[model samples]
Target: MEPALRRAYRRESEETRRADLIAATQELVAEGGPEAATVRAIAARAGVTAGLIRHYFHTKDELTRAAYLSLMDGMTAKGSDALEGVGAAPEERLAAFVSASLRPPVLDVGAVVLWAGYMHKVRTDPELKTVHEAAYLAYRDMLQSLIAALPRSASDAQLRAEAIACNGLIDGLWVEGSILSHAFAPGEIVTIGLRSVGAILGVDLIAHSAMLPDPGKILP
Candidate 1:
């Protein structure tokens, strides 16, 4: 192979290995909490040597942090991706995003486990705490932007307040939906989320929910 081609292949291989390690770490953490994701266990899960983890991450804490960040990023991306082809209407976009968030794979038990597993560390570790805060801010900021785009006029302070409330509502629903999924009927969470958010924003999000690509598809 040409030198450039060889280099590209090597880089891709390295990244793939790194991702596999992180995936293994996340799986272990979700299954048995953060304590289960030791370097040796991660290596065993990934089918790689423990030394390989050192090649990618300086320490176990570093690897765990990366996994946490990846989990949060994946959740955020799911909500953002739902906005695509959702039309230019702010209400439609917001409703679609909320629906996506309340359903799988964002609303899965494993994802919630991964999040909960990291919470203890996030409290004691400054770097992890920063990651947690940044993730929260980013999610809230996205919601704030969506709320701001609505036809209703609101000051910056009001928008921020609404975003915080809406985020809290969604977070609570997501946790309940994940932990006690059998408690709610299909589409119940999504319906409640839209109506509650609508009430908060003083806009009928249910009216715009029809704009979703397949409203019945994600209602779990």
Candidate 2:
């Protein structure tokens, strides 16, 4: 075993272990809120000793904060990944992004539960609140970029305003669809989201979305 090879292996192993701990924390938090994700419970869930958590995170709060950020980052990645292979049309790309956000994985029950579980801490803990605000800004920035790409000319202020509005619309629909999923028909939230967002941006997202070779592929 060469020194370089050994170092690479050790780094990979450490990252894998850290990821496992974060996964365990997210699962416990989702299952029983933040209180269930104690360091002991996280270690047990990850099949590691409690002290092992200290090696990766300075404290339980740090670990919980990491899990929350992981959850939020994953959601943003899901939406961004939806843009892959999408055409240059701004409307199509925006529609795909919104649809991806409103559908499964991003709109899953467990994900929402995990987010809600951390709400209290995010509100009171200054560090966690900073993370929450940063995540929100990142998502909103992405929305603003997508909106800026549209055909119609808009000033920075207008783009920012539209992005905020669209973000709120999507967030509301996402929460309702996740918690009261049964209350709405399949694809209802997606349709509403596209229409509402399209109206805000002064484009027909549904019509543009339909232009795709297989609209159902993204919409579903």
- Which candidate leads the pack in TM-score? 1
Q: What is the lDDT of candidate 2?
A: 0.85
Least well predicted 10-residue stretch by lDDT in candidate 1: 1-10
Question: How do the residues 64-123 of candidate 2 rate in per-residue lDDT, one tens digit apiece?
Answer: 888899999889999898888889999999988898889898888888888989997877
Worst 10 residues of 2 by lDDT: 1-10
- For each of the candidates, the C-alpha root-mean-square deviation to the true structure, in angstroms, is 6.6, 6.7
C-alpha lDDT of all candidate models, in order: 0.86, 0.85
Q: What tens digits encode model 1's per-residue C-alpha lDDT throughout 63-107?
A: 988898888888988999999888999999999988988988888
